[model samples]
Target chain A: MSASSRRGVDVGALVEQARDGSPRAVARLVSMVEDASPALREVAATLAPHTGHAYVVGLTGSPGVGKSTSTNALVGAVRARGLRVGVLAVDPSSPFSGGALLGDRVRMQEHATDAGVFIRSMASRGHLGGLSWGTPQAIRVLDGAGCDVILVETVGVGQAEIEIASLADTTIVLLAPGMGDGIQAAKAGILEIADVFVVNKADRDGAQSTVRDLQGMLGLGGRYADDAHWRPPIVKTVAARNEGVDDVLAAIDAHRAWLEKTGGLRSRRRERAAREVEAIAVAALRARIGDLRGGVALDSLADQILDGKLDPYAAADALLAETSD
Target chain B: MSASSRRGVDVGALVEQARDGSPRAVARLVSMVEDASPALREVAATLAPHTGHAYVVGLTGSPGVGKSTSTNALVGAVRARGLRVGVLAVDPSSPFSGGALLGDRVRMQEHATDAGVFIRSMASRGHLGGLSWGTPQAIRVLDGAGCDVILVETVGVGQAEIEIASLADTTIVLLAPGMGDGIQAAKAGILEIADVFVVNKADRDGAQSTVRDLQGMLGLGGRYADDAHWRPPIVKTVAARNEGVDDVLAAIDAHRAWLEKTGGLRSRRRERAAREVEAIAVAALRARIGDLRGGVALDSLADQILDGKLDPYAAADALLAETSD
Candidate 1:
């Protein structure tokens, strides 16, 4: 290991502890990586070889839509089916405190002490698209440690939250009644990415109407053929009362089975692997360019461009020319 | 012009006609670009030199949320101040019909014959985000044609719609009462980018409460001293009655003044220019790479990686080596 890696912390040892089933060690590792400690890359390289086991499920929706309650109920349902489940609830980072509430952890206390369950709450930390750089790495650690199902709950909506859909095998979009305007507004982003739609708080007055409206809209712009068989399904749940959780689980199972039957799961996994490689490569290239000798030239160029002394195209050309030499 | 540019319709001539105040020519130019015609890129290049004249304003919210009504009223307010206006109402493309309702055009018919007012509808055409690739170029055409203010209404609430915020000098996010769930869900993306917030249909039951909730949320976030002068102002509007339209316009003016006074506008413009250059460079690189002599070999490697026959990292390395040689 390099000096920076050594002096930072022994993340590999913590990974080993986590693999051997130490919750505290896993928690510590997650925190270290989320904070982008220098040792994260080392830990990630160590853990990469053991990943690809878990079926990651992403749940997203507007706030106050019962995402937490639904997640907790889903965990209970999954446990009853004899599956080892792990939950990663991403919370909004407090811009002031730079900390997260981890409220989902508190809300799901029923499974907190269960040896079969592991729960972690992550803060967004100003990461664009609501994902920290360490999220995929943390998921790898959990997957390597033998979690069968990993549930990821986003802190917010739109493109950032939708990114979870790209990372997860199955993505569920939660909605509530009286969100007609919001749903219409979000049609361009969240609605496009949903693998399944769940209308939570189904006991509300406009529950049936909301479902009908969504169904009508889906019909008008459906991307899948009725015969395609893995089309996104709509489910209704009153998560607070734990109603309709089984139906949601059944829908997930059906989707998984379809993925396997159609040989889509393998293809999806391959796509994900390729994407991960590309993301990492791009990030590494940017970092290396930042660390080059005379790299401060780029910063100075930015200042010049900001001050209108240089056009952006001319500055980019100059930067590229300098790098080429 | 190249053979490919000549064989197709001359986009520059069309643009010149549009600039000479021909509404039919402007409409046709938008259509040609939106359809991704072969000569679109060349046309965009020609139009680029004429951009940076108009102040682009983006208004976005959920469908069925009175966005059209608000936009129509805002156009009147802007024109009443003796400024020529152009409105681009972007709608989601239907997966089945490959068409859009163009509903906003009909709703804003009051200005159809005003000569100074131009309105057009754009379809999303499967672009993942809300804004289409041709939007900026279309805005440039309108700018060169002497529109004092260009208003872009996004297709939906997705992150693509939020892209308009980055492109426009000012962005207004419209929310209605009972959209608390949507607000909570989309807060992470929309709130961060909003220059002005509008709680439309404020006569609704939950309007006051929702505004209060938003205020509380904004308070909990850290305050930047630089933003103090241009803090996003929330205004209530009843578009049907034309109430609060003046306040919204005044708020936009105030924000623009603050942006200029604080030097935020110049810095933001610089960042945008840089990003645009980066986007163009990346696109050019992708196109050039596809036309290289060893392009087939690179493509085959990419296929192998996608099929999982070879690891993505190894394939990337091989491609990079081949290209360098």
Candidate 2:
């Protein structure tokens, strides 16, 4: 297809195909949404009525913590429960090559041919946060595609990964043992968002000690109000060996149950929807600003500041003055 | 001082004291400015004439990766060269306590009584990018204080830490050996910005392998047309023992020399200043929007979105209607 034609994808036909269980259509729709095409937004207006079904589980961690392996194992476990699964592995685009390596696909080879499973990788494309603006919209596409569960594996680049906490209903923070003070650092921003902590690579020597240290750091609970129905649980797992995957699945089920009973799940979904809309609005504003010769003016102001002809404050004032109120 | 009184500091007196080589004045100025008060910005305007002498170096890494130790050792190294040093360590506010722990003070105790070195710690205070909006103004305070070099130590929370890269002349990304997979993950966002890479904890078993991996991943010896005059070098260090710090200083000096020769440093500094101004302007707009009850309308629109009474697109359109030209 021509690039313009691809960009101007027929949203209704794609949605129909996705609803009728065409994986190619689902992938195309995901691409369209992730690109934040205006056409895709129109499609989302139609698909929004069909969403709110899939139980989204976000998987995130410091890179090399085996999140993909854990996600693969979780997919298997969820499949064993007779539910369809959709996986969205968010990775950074190579600055040299705009294409994502789709590293998660290699690890998730087992699900490649499984009709009940769908896997897609989203690239950052140097977006402000690690997630693209269209991520929530893409998630809705997966939701409308009849997937019982959707797993979002985040780019484990720290604070940006925390945005996933706001996006997912259940967020699992994966960690490996013996990372030499990494656990303490991880606790700085990501710890609070974790609905479940999976100490992956449990076969490693310091796995038990890592768990003990984390439990000690967490300090006997009640940090958050107890009224939420479920407390975050730390589960030990050897993802490569497929051990403890069942426990992780059980923990997810328990959290989902609590979310349903306490109405927290609905509230979280509502917040996510709100955030998605705000993000889209902000992105549109940025793009509009860019097209209004803002980039050229910004560069010239930057040069003037460098030349000492203009101080930053005055330059900012001038830029703001140019913006129509 | 009462917190508000502390906020209402005398910038002129502080600038005069700083010019006369008073560390206390510099410290108070940084403290006043780091709070991001309008008063601080006013102070900055008065001090702007006396600023632009100090070379700013931003040091960042994941928390517990020994950024403080490295920064302390760096201060020592810079002082040995007879240049006065100023350190600003940015720490995230404790969610539970709402007070900063000021951990850099504990780590850099050797310089506590030094008349030549001024150290201050800043709290992130929920700033989105791990930097308060007033940080550049604080740097101006230190600059006007006659410090030869100012080192900014970031909160080390990954993505938020990237903000430091924009503000500093030379940015160093610290990693430790045996953080294998974590290194790959960090490479996804941060490794590209490293003007210098220090492999801390080089005493570990996989230190050499880690260095080799980094060298391979970075593809050294490949010449690019846009290459900065000084190529970033990977240095090994054991921060606790203060090993290889001199080499880091030498690398920084070399980078500085190259920056000056190529006029890259001046341009980079100007770019940073321009960016700071733009950020402030954006923040002002956002604050104004909030003050006008724009957020209330947005929130109500969000509620309508959750109730399915209004679609996100329409809600966004409605929210921007007043602002749209």
lDDT of 1 at A321: 46
Lowest lDDT 10-residue stretch of candidate 2 chain A? A93-102
- Interface C-alpha RMSD per candidate, 1 decimal: 6.3, 4.4
lDDT, candidate 1, A214-296, per-residue tens: 77766767566333545678899999898999999888887888777777676666555544444444344334345542346
lDDT string, candidate 1, B1-325, tens digits = 8754468677677778877788998887777657656565555555655666688888887766688899989999999999989988766544321244345557888888888898887765553233434566567668867789999887445665567777788999888889663465345477777788888999999989878876765666653436454567889999988999999999999888888888877666655554443443333333334454234665565456444355444544454344333
Give the alpha carbon lDDT tens digit for every residue of B1-325 in model 2. 5333465666566668888888777766766655555665555555666667789898877766678889989999999999989887766543221243345567788998888898877665454334636667677678777789999887566554677888889988887877663465345466667788888888988888878877766675363324454556889999889899999998888788878888888777877776676666566545544543445666676666655566666665565553432
Q: What lDDT, from 0 to 1, does candidate 2 have?
A: 0.73
Clashing pairs in 2: none
Worst 10 residues of 1 chain B by lDDT: B279-288
Q: Write the per-residue lDDT of candidate 2 for residues A231-300, one digit (tens) a residue.
A: 5788999999999999998898888888888888887887777666666655555554455344677778
lDDT of 2 at A22: 89
Q: Give the TM-score of candidate 2.
A: 0.58
TM-score of chain A of each: 0.83, 0.83
Question: What is the C-alpha DockQ of each candidate?
Answer: 0.09, 0.18
